[model samples]
Target: MLTSTGKLLSMGGKPRNKSLSLPFLMNISNTASKQMTKLRTLQIGNVDVIGSRFNGQELHSALCAEGFDSHHLVWRKMGSDAKTTEIDYPFKTPMNNALKKLESDLSIQSILHPAPFAIALNEHFRAADLVHYHLLHTGWFSLLGLPLLTKNKPSIMTLHDPWSMTGHCSYPRSCDRWMTGCGDCPDLEVIQLMKKDNTHGMWKAKRDVFAKANLEIVVASKWMLEKVQTSPIFSHFKHHLIPFGIDLEKFRPGDSEVARKKLGIYPGNTVICLRATVSPFKGLPYIYEALEKLSTTKPLTILTLEDKQLFKDYLGKHQLIDLGWLEDSNLIAEAYRAADIFLMPSTAEAFGVMAIEAMASGKPTIVFEGTSLPEVTFAPKGAIAVPMGDSDALTESLRRLIENKELRNSIGKEARQLAEAHYNWKTHVSRIIELYEQVMSEKATKANR
Candidate 1:
C-alpha cells in the first residue's frame, strides 16, 4: 500500500492511532478495484524501432506486445524542394529530416485524423489512463509538440540518454566544454553556424521547458536515475528506474560448433566478438588496444558488423573479421553462440543492451565497472567486470576465459539464468502495467474527492 504523498503505507499491522480510519480504508479498497480495470494508453515517440534496425525500435515492439495502444509518431524532415519527395542521391538521410516528418504528421493528425497524443488525451483525461513519452528533449519534439501534450495530460517521459539532463545536446565525455553549459560546442559548426551566446540561450530554454513539464521521469538504469536526481534539469520530477528488456527466445544458447560452421569460422580457433554500430562512444579504440596486447598467443578473432575501414584504421596489424550489417535475428543469435565471450568497453552507456543480449545467448560478457555496464552485467557467475579504460585488466579477463573452458561454461550458464530472471521482456512489461495501475488509481481517487 502507498500513501497519496508517494510514501509506503503499512498494512498487516495494528492501527497506531485510536481512529479506525474507515474513509482511508475505503479509499484503498476502491483504488484496488480501479487497478483491476483495463486501461487504454497512448505512447508518443519520434522514432519507431519495430521496422528500424535500432535498439529503440526493439523497445517499441516490446511495449506494443505488452497490450498498450502504442503508436509511434516519427518526424519526417521537409526538403527545400517540397514537390520532389523522391530522391536519387545515395547519401544517408539526416535525423533532422525524421524529426520534421514527425512534427508534420502530428500537426496534420490533430486537425483531421488526430495524432495519438491529442486523441488519447482529449478522450481519456477523465478515465483511467497514462501517456508515455519517449525521448522528450530531442530539441525539435520538445520545442514544438511536448508543450501541447504535457500541458494538462498525466505524462511520463523515459530518458534514453543524458542529453536532456545536460545543456549540451551531445554528450560531454569526449569533449570538456559540454560539462559547463555547452558554449563553444565542438559539433556546432557541423550542425549550424551559431554564436556561443546563442547556443547558451538555446540550452537554457531547453532546460527551463524540461523543468516546468511536471513529468514522471523514467530512467533505464539506476546510474541514470542518480544522475538525473542530482542534475538541475529533473531534480523536481518523480523518478522511476525501469531497465529495458530483451527477447530471450531470440537470443538463447545454441551449438557452438554448428554456429561457427555456419559463420565459416575454423573448427579450432576461439572467437571473441564485439557488436556495436561503429561509434566512438562504444570504445572501439580500447578493444583494439586489448586485442593488440593479446595478439601473439591468443589466436583470437574479433568479429563486428561495423565499418570495415574504420575498424581497420583503428586496428592496424590486428585482424578483425567484418560480418557487415546483419538484419536477421536468427543469424545474429547464431553469431552470438559462435563466440566464446562478448566484449564491450563503452565509455558511457545509459544501459548496456548488447551486454544483456549476449548474456541471454548463454555467453559470458566482459564489461567495465562504472557507468551502466556494471549495473547491467553484475551477475557474479555471468559476467566479468574490469576497471574502465584499463586495457591490461581487459586483456587479463579475456585471457582467463580463453584458457579455462570449464570456467567459461559455468559463467555462461549463470549469465543465461540471470537474463531469464531479470532481462526478459515479459517481466519488464508486467512491472510497467503495475506502475500504470498504481498511478492511475491514485489520480482517480483524488478526482473523486
Candidate 2:
C-alpha cells in the first residue's frame, strides 16, 4: 500500500481488494518492505520503455500490466507522449549537457563527477522490494552512482553491452583486453574521446566500485551471457538470461495488398527491408552491396525507416521508400506487410528484437549467422541465416525469396507461428515476474533470519 507521501507500506495493516489509485511511483525509503507479504517490484531504465517502441520499453509495459509499480526514469524524452512519474536527471546547463554527451563512450568522467539523478534514486531507491536497472549510459546517469544507489539492496543490472565490462567500448568486437584488464586500448580513436586512454583505470574503478554493491545480473542473449561468465567483474555475481519479446497484436500480419497500395507500391514490385543505424556492425555496407547486385528486371524498392539523406550516397538510382523514424507500431506493421522480405544482415546483435518484430508481422527475415541472430531468427523457419558479411550470400537469399512467392509465403507463415509460440509478451513477462518473486522471496527469508 502507498501512503500519502508515496511510500510502500505492508498491506496487512490495510484492507484487501482496494484499488491502488495512488500515482504509479512512490518513494518508500525507511519504510521496511520485509513486513509486506506481497511482492512489489521497482524497474528502472533510462527511458519510459512503456511509451517508447524499443525492446526494453516493451518489457516495461508488460511489467506494468502484471501489476508491478513500474516506472522508467529517463534522462531525456524523444517524443512528446509523456508518461507519469518519470524522474529526469537534473542537468546543470544546456551547454554543459551537450559537452558531456561527447564523453558518452567513456565512464571516466562519470567516475569523477556525480549526477543529480543519483540524488533522486537515493530518495526513492529503498521504496521498492527489488530494483532492476537497465541500459544507463546515454549521456546522463553515471555508473559511478551505481554502488552507492544500489548498496545492500536486492538489485539487478541487465547487461545490454560490454561497456560495463570494458573500460570504454560498448561492443568490444575482436578485443579481449577486458578479460585480463582493460589497458593499452585498441579502439581509442574509434571511441572519439577528447582525452587519452585511461581504460585500465576506468575498468579497475568499476571493479572496485561495483564490488561494494549487492547486485544481480541479467543478459538478453546467450552471447552476452557468455561474456558475463568470462568477465572478471561480472563473473562474481548471480545472473539471469531473458530474451526480448514483442506485442503480437500490434505487430500482427496485415493485408499485404492493401499495405502495398497504401504505400503507393505498384503490382509486380518487390520490396526489400533494411533497418539500423549507419554503423559498420549493423552490416550497412553489406546491405548496400547486396542490393547493388540484385536483379533489376522487376521493379525493386528498398523500404527503410531511416531518412533518405542518411543513405543518399548508397541510393544509386534505386527506388527508395523512406519512412524516416517510426514510433507508431501500426505504421511499422504496415511497412512489414508491404515488404516481400526483411533483411538484417548484421554481425552483432543482443537478441535481435526487430528481426522478431518483422517475423511477427509475417515477413520472412534474412540475417547473417553470428551472435544472437541465429538464436533469435529461428532460421529456415522464420528467417534464412546467411553467411555473415557475404553480399553474394545475401543476394542469393534475397533472390530466392523474391523469385518464389509460395516459398516466401510459407516462410512468413512459419515466422508468425514461431513468434506466437516463443516471443509473445505474456510468456516473457511471466518469466521476469518469476525472477522477481525469487529475488523477493530470498530477501524475505534473509529478513526473517
Candidate 3:
C-alpha cells in the first residue's frame, strides 16, 4: 500500500509521513523540503448534495470535518451551509432562460450554458487540487468546456445515472443503443427528453469531450458499471464501484410502535413507505397496480415521503399518509422506522439510497429485477425482488412479507447486516478520499515522467 514516494501508507490509503502530522496531504514538491499542502477538492453538481435527492451532503461535511478543504458548487443553494457556494453566471437570468429554451429545442444538453466557464473562473475551482462532478446533466453545465475546465487537474465524475453515456435518456430502460454511437433513439420522451432526434450529435459531443478530458468514472452499483463498460463514450475511462452509504446510527432499527405513534398511525395496519415523486422511470404505475391485487385482512396505510401524493384517490379503503417533502434527517428516519415495508420498484435506478436506508432501518424492502436495486440490495438475500413491471409478482412478494411476520423479521435483519458491512458512511468517505489520493499520485507520477 506504499505510495510512489515510499511514504508510509495506512490501511485507509492515506500517507503517514513522520515529518507531517496530517494524514491527508498533497506532496506538491519532491525537493529537499517536501512541501506538504492540505488537499482542496471542488465538487460541482446541479444542486447541493445535502438536499433530499442523495447522501452527498454527508460526504461534503465529512470532508470538511476530516480537515480537507472541500467546497460544493451547486447551481441552486438550498441551505446556509458555508461549504456550499451557488454558481453565479455572468449573463442575466432572462438571457440564460432564453438560452435554455433554445438548447432544449435543439436537443443540445449543457452546451448553451456559460456555467462551465463560470465554474472554471470560480476561486474554489482554481485552488482545487481535484474536482469531482456529480449530476451534471441537469442542463446547467457545459459539456463543450469540460476538457478545458478540467485541464491539468485530476477530475472525477460520479455517474449518478446513465445519462453521461447515452444520447438523451438517463436509464435507457431496456435499450442498449448506448453501446453503439446512439443514433435513431427508440424513445425521445424519456427523462432529459429531446425535442428532436439530435441524440447522435449529443452523444458524439460527450464522446469528444471525454476523449480529451482526464476524467475517472465512479458508479455506486455493479449494474451501473456494466453499462459504463458497454458505453462507447465512457468505457475507456477508469471506473470506481463505490456504493452509497447512510448514517447507520440515525437509520438503525427502532420501535415501530413509538414511530407509528409519533407519525399519528393507529395499530392494526400494515404500513408501506415509498418515495412520493411520480416519474416514468420509478415504476409508479406498477406499484399502483400491485396495490390493487393485494387482498389483506389488516388495513393498509400508505406512507409517502417527498412531494407528490399519488395514493389519495388510488387507495380506496386503505389509508394515505403523505408527510410531504422532508429536509431534516431525523424526520426522514422516523418515517422509515414507522414503516413495516419499504418498496422501490424502479425500472431504471442507478443506485437507490432509500433502499439501503430502509435496509439499515431494519425494514423488509422489495424491489424489481432488471435494475440496480436487485444488485444494490443483494437480491432475494438482503431484499425481496420481483420481476420488473410484474404487478402480480409484486403482489405475491408483498403478501409473503405481510402474512409472515417471521419472514419479514429475518429479511430485515439480514438487510441491516448487509447495509452495515457494505455501506458504512465512514468507509464510503475514506474510499473516496483514497481515490482522490490515487488520482493525484498518478498525475504527479506522469508529470515527473
Candidate 4:
C-alpha cells in the first residue's frame, strides 16, 4: 500500500499557518514520521559509479544504503559514437558493462527533448511516493526531462554549482555577466558565435520552469546558499544547505613513514600535496609559482593527481612527483598521511571534499579564504586561509608550514578531530534522509489540500 506521512500531517489538523520556515519544517519532519506512515522514495540522477568526476555516484550510494528505492537513469544519444566506458580502474564489474550498453541505446538528442524522456520518467514517477533530483544545468537529462518529472511528483533539486543560476554553466569570476544577465559571453567567441541577447529571456524561461515545479533547492555550501539567496532566478524556491560527507574509515590517518615509503618520498622530506584533476579554476598556476619561489631552498616534493603529460608540460623539468589518479582509498589516505601540508587554492569551489579528506588523513590544509573552501576548512587553527589569487600569501603560508613542524602537527590533529566530529558519512546521510522525509511530508499535505 502507498502511504505518505505528509498526507497524515495535512489531515491531522490545520496549523495556524501553512507556511513553515526551514527549521520548523525540519522539526516537523523529524517528529512527524514517527507518528505517521512510511513512504517509498524515488531518486533521479545520472549515477555512473565508475565515472569518478560526478557527485551522482556518492549521492546514489548514500541513498541506496538508507533503503530508498533508488533508480538511476542515464540518457545519451543512440547510434552515437560517444564512448561510455568505466574510467580506467582496477575493479570493473558486470553492472558497469550493462550501464554502458544502456547508455549506448539512449540518444542524446532524444534525452534533450521533453516529450519522450518525460514519458519514460513519468512511468517511474507514478510509482514513487517522493522524488529527488540531482541537477546539472547543461545536461540533456536536466534540461529536457526535469520539468516533466516534476509535474506529477513532489521534487527537490540539488544544485552542485552556480551554472543554473547564470546563463553560463560556470563563472569563476566576473559576476557582472550573470548579474546583468549573460549576453556577449567571453566563451561565445571561442565557439565562433556572434554576440547573442537572450540573457534575461533565457534565465527567465529556465527560472519559470523550475519555480512552477513546487520544488525546493539544496546547496552543498553556505557560500552557495548565500549566492542562491541573492540570485533573482533562485530566490523564490525553498532553500536548504547540506554539505558532502567523506568515508572516514578509508580516509583516516595512516602511518606517515609507511605512506612516504610507498609513494617513494625520502623518509624526512617535507611533502606538500595538492589532489585535483588539472583545470584552470583549480589554481594550479599559483601553486606552480609558489613552488618555484621555494623549490631551491626547501627539500620539498610536490605531488598531484593530474595527466602525466600536462603536469610535465606545466612543470618543465621541475622535480615533482606525479601520481596519476589513485582510486584506492588506502593509497589516497597514505598520500595524505605522507604529506606535511595539503594545498587547495581553487578560485571557485562549491565544497572542498578533498580538503576534508586530507583533514581526515590528519594533514593541515592551506586554502583560499574567499569561497566555499573557508566554509569547508572552517578556518581551523592548523589551516591557513590566504586571500584568494594572492601568490605571495600562498608562498608565505607554504613556507610557514614547511618551517614549523609543531604547528603543522597541531593543526593536523585538530583537522582530524573536526572531520571525525562533523564530516563523517553516517552523520551527513542521516541529515539528508531527514530533509527528504520533510519535503515528502510537505508535498503530501499540499496534495491532500
Model 2 worst lDDT run, 10 consecutive residues: 21-30
- The order by descending lDDT is 3, 2, 4, 1
- Poorly placed runs, candidate 4 (over 4 Å): 1-38, 50-54, 76-123, 142-144, 186-201, 313-319, 380-382
Task: State residue 173's C-alpha deviation in candidate 4, in Å.
Answer: 2.1
Q: Residue-wise lDDT of candidate 3 within 264-311, one digit each (tens)?
A: 886878888998777888878888898889987977789998866578
Name every residue pair that clashes in candidate 3. Answer: none
Candidate 4's residue-wise lDDT over 61-127, tens digit each? 5555545555444332222212221122222344445443443344111123332244343555577
lDDT of each: 0.61, 0.68, 0.80, 0.63
TM-score of each: 0.74, 0.83, 0.90, 0.78
Error of 2 at 169 (Å): 1.2
Q: Pick the candidate with the highest lDDT.
A: 3
Over the stretch 1-449, how does candidate 2's per-residue lDDT look in tens digits?
22222233321234232321111112111122232324445556656633353424555555555555654444444444333244534564563466575554443655433453454454445566677777665555567677767766788777777778887777777788999888888776543242568888878987886777688777766678788878987887776776666779888888889998898776878888778467656888888788778775667777887545555654556567788777677888889989888989877776777889899999899998866787777887788998777899999888888888899999999999988877766545655655566577788899999
- Backbone clash total for model 2 is 1
After superposition on all C-alphas, the RMSD of every candidate to the true structure, in Å, is 8.6, 8.4, 5.1, 8.5
What is the clash tally of candidate 3?
0
